[model samples]
Target chain A: MHIAVEEEKCVGAGQCVLAAMEIFDQRDEDGVVVLLDAEPPEEQHAAARDAAAVCPAAAIAVRE
Target chain B: MSAPSRVVVVGASAAGLSVAETLRRRGFDGQVTLIGEEDHPPYDRPPLSKQILSGEWPEERVWLRDEATLAGLNLDLRLGVAALSVDPADRVVVLADGSRVTYDELVIATGVRARRLPGTDGLAGVHTLRTLSDARALRETLAAWPRLVVVGAGFLGTEAAAVARAMGAEVTLVSDLEAPLSDVLGAELGELLVRVHAEHGVKIISGVVVREVLASGGRAAGVRLADGRVVEADAVLVSIGSLPNVDWLAGSGIDTGDGVHCDEYCQAGPGVWAAGDVASWIHPAAGGRMRVEHRTNAGEQGMAVARNILSAGHPAPFAPVPYVWSDQYDRKIQIYGSPRGCDRFAVTDGSLAERRLVALYGRDDLVRATVGINMVRSVRAARALVATPTPWDSIEQGVTA
Candidate 1:
């Protein structure tokens, strides 16, 4: 499973980081979404998909 | 292990409904059921103080989306049904009618209620406005009561006073502070609000605490001040603040504080999420946890919760630059971002004397937030700045120009 994030639409609300901390991180300054690992392990697929679903800006993309 | 995902949403307000809509929008073909204590469908609450109170807009207009919208999405909406307990361990929500609904995911969007005056019972003309019923009752009372005494000078209290004054009711607005909005907007801006109300003939009483409600014939007649001053009135409107609805989460095994504790993704526990006024999530910027109770926060947080429920992995963190607006006496006050820790402010456009200006709050040489009074364009510009890391020097230069 892979999680792709579009940086343009991200508002840095940090909903994705709460779901999958290993796969996502927020910028220290402005709090924008930073994709730590796009292709997370298969076991973390569910959490990554959730991160994609909850992105307020619709910035996250999930591929399985 | 291939059972269909069952999502049960507790509360059909902005957060819950937004989650449902977001789920369907994201192509989630799962069973989505909404349980609400209110019999009516979810409605927009911000208008309650402005248009609804002023009689400019009707009840139906405040509704966010209608029954057709809900039906189109095929959402199972259980209106007027309250959740008695939430057994997160078993992933089930128990209702007041002894019915239990099991869910693979849950979203808690239960909002807050208006806080009432302490020990002011048995007074006929006392009112607190939060829901549709409260507005309707206050509207009826305002029609009969010639003089209206408002007990607080916060956003709601100020808006109500403006509406009541516009409706030809003599309004006496009392606040614990020397000026209205002192705690939130500071003394300078607070004084501006006081001036605005005074210019409209709304009697402003400041720095006075209400000792007791003076009643005659089991009806409110006036209020007694601690300084031995008596202000007579026909009706009293109490708009102190709100208390988040998190009482039912007791013993539910969910981490609860002043509100339901959630992380950045608005998730409280496994298969459980919360948003709106009742959810306090961690703020990365402030390095603390705070619950924002604004319309914009509710809508955005609700949508975020919806996506989190559909997918198991963490979504992006909920880090919206907080924004809120209030309309009173033909003036709109808009705030972008949080200004709690701001140390300095600079006026960019308009002057305080003109009652039309934009002020930017800065901390550690960065523009943290901006506030505009009757200045919409600047607020939009400020919102853009909040999304980026802009230095205070550049912000000042841009605003001055």
Candidate 2:
């Protein structure tokens, strides 16, 4: 699965990192979301989707 | 998108409504459902303690967005229906009646409730103001009770005391701290708050904790202090603090502490998000986790949450210049930015004794925050100073670019 993030609308409220740290991370300085792997292995698809789902700003998009 | 994804918003207060409105405004045509525990629509809360309590503005005036706004957005609002539980895995929100509504996105803005005095069980005239119902009940009692003993010298307590005093009722403000607002605003400003109350004829009792409510005939008589002092009064106003409403997330697998932990974007977990008083967000500027309970924070954070929800990728971080205001007596106090770790303050525009001035707080030779009392223009200048780090000397000289 591949995830797309809209950086314009993201607030660094790190809900995505909590859900799937391997998939999403936040920039240390401004705390913006930093998607580690846009597309991950099949085993991590659920976590990626969960990361997208819990984003308060709805900034993440997961695609199969 | 096949069809605008279904978004379920829990709580119809400032945070919830702001998210829903921002969703529709951002072209999210999907089914949007807003569920509120209260029967009334989302209303402005800050005015509840001031104008509404003083009878200057009616209850209806506080309604934030009217039915027209809801209809214009093409949003479905479910008022008076409390959300019982949320299943993040299934993306379903369970209502009080056991009905389940599935959602692609969920926003939790349940807010907080007033913490009451424990073991004060059978107090007849004790009151706490949080919701419209509480305010209405207190308003009715104020007409009958001529004296009010306000527990806690915080913002709400002081405001209520001022309103009651304006209504010709005797008010005595009791606080556990050495001065009112000591914990938040520090001892210096806290002492000023106490003096303000005292000058207004509101008796100020500091460093005393309420042991219990002394009652008779199933009604409140007075409060017994930890210092063994019993102050007589007809009614008591408890404004100690607020506890975030996170009980529903007990087994919800979401990492919950004092509040639902969220990143800078205000996300909680997959398909679940939180804002307002219920969100313990990591402040970007401060680099620390803090929960902001102010109305401005709730509205701004809610909008940020909505924008992030509609985006396709990692969105821009939501970082607002945090601001909060309180109205007491004739003074309008405005605070900008986080006031933590400030070692020095400079009075820029006016004198402190005049009670209409601007004060800048600085740390490490950089401006940290600003507090303005009845000085609106200076507050705007101070806000600019907070946004960009400026020297204390420059701030004292009223330098702004």
Candidate 3:
């Protein structure tokens, strides 16, 4: 699975980091989302998807 | 006793949609029915006060999902229909069109409706911003640059005031507090917002109660303050608060006092659950029952409900460090935890005069919450301060260091 993020759309709620800290982080300067991993192993797919699903701004997109 | 063969969810907004999506993600595949009162598909509400109001993005951008993605869920989608009542004992929900749907499990996420002043119904040029249609009407009225009076200086009212003023409307903000959002963000930060609004040419009338909305020619003329001072306007937006949509569950035997009363797990009754703004559940962390109206809480609670529904006999409590945010002009105000009733508030980082800082709220020697204005990273990091209610002394020492 591959993950993509839109910095402009990110509200910096940090919900993505809460769902999957290993796959996502936020910049310190601004809270725009930081994609730590664009591709993840099978075990991390569910967490990645959950991060996308719970994003309030719909800033994260996961392509499986 | 067994896994639910069919799950029925009421209200198709963020919380309801989250439950349905989570169920499918968990491979439930059961007959999932999602019902909504609005004809539009599930969309985000946070943008309605800003982007949608300012015409920065079209209505389509607010949709939570596109056509093809929603179709993939294969839901029993019922749009533009309202749920009249629920018969919990019979496990059936009666619809407005006289149709009934039976379910093994039920989730209610009806959310809330915008509160209006008494006797303002059907009045021309009087509006409330809650649904997409409400935003559309308010936007159309704002385009004409009418003299707009916004009652109640809460987040919704404050944001709408900023938008209308930016749209070149003669905007006047009237509220009972000393400053806008002082009741939630405290007077210091609230005063900072007052300066922000004033610098943008927005007139603010605070510390006065609106006695009545004046009408001339059968339209909203303006509002009369309790002090007998009158402010005339061509349009008025009332943003006082909201009432949870629990009236439909009148005879359903579910508690609807303030909202759908639920346990720590968001369960209302046997095989029944509630989420989003319509849910007033016991929060283990908050040490009491609470109902959050923020966008993030809606989706988070929905996921928790779906997980508990699938787990059946073994349900986990929904404990979260509640978060909420607001955007007005150049300021992005974000809050973590509950800041209401905090005995003490201190600027731990930055300065209030600069309007960019991190503040902490303490109650009974424990950090209760944190607020940030244009200081996103600091506020996000401060979540740990109140995630489990840390001691104020520890936070103070850390700040001093």
- Cα RMSDs, all models: 9.0, 11.9, 1.5
Quick one: best DockQ, which candidate? Answer: 3
Per-residue lDDT of candidate 2, residues B183-223 (tens digit): 65655666677788898899988888999887878888889
Candidate 1: Cα lDDT at B116: 77
**For each candidate, what is the lDDT?**
0.80, 0.79, 0.91
Q: Report residue B119 deviation for candidate 1 (angstroms).
A: 2.2
lDDT of 1 by residue, B53-153 (tens): 77776678766665666787898889998998899999999998889999988888888988877777656899888888878878888776479999989
> What TM-score against the true chain A does chain A of each candidate get?
0.92, 0.93, 0.95
lDDT of 3 by residue, B299-366 (tens): 99999999999996899999988899888888888899888888878888878877889999989999
Docking quality tier of model 1:
incorrect
What is the fraction of true interface contacts found in candidate 1? 0.00
Task: Pick out the ten consecutive residues of candidate 3 chain B with the lowest summed lDDT.
Answer: B392-401
Q: For candidate 2, lDDT tens digit of each residue in A1-64?
A: 7789978555455557756878877664344688889888988887786566445455676667
Candidate 2 ranges with C-alpha deviation above 4 Å = A1-64, B1-4, B391-401
Error of 1 at B73 (Å): 1.4
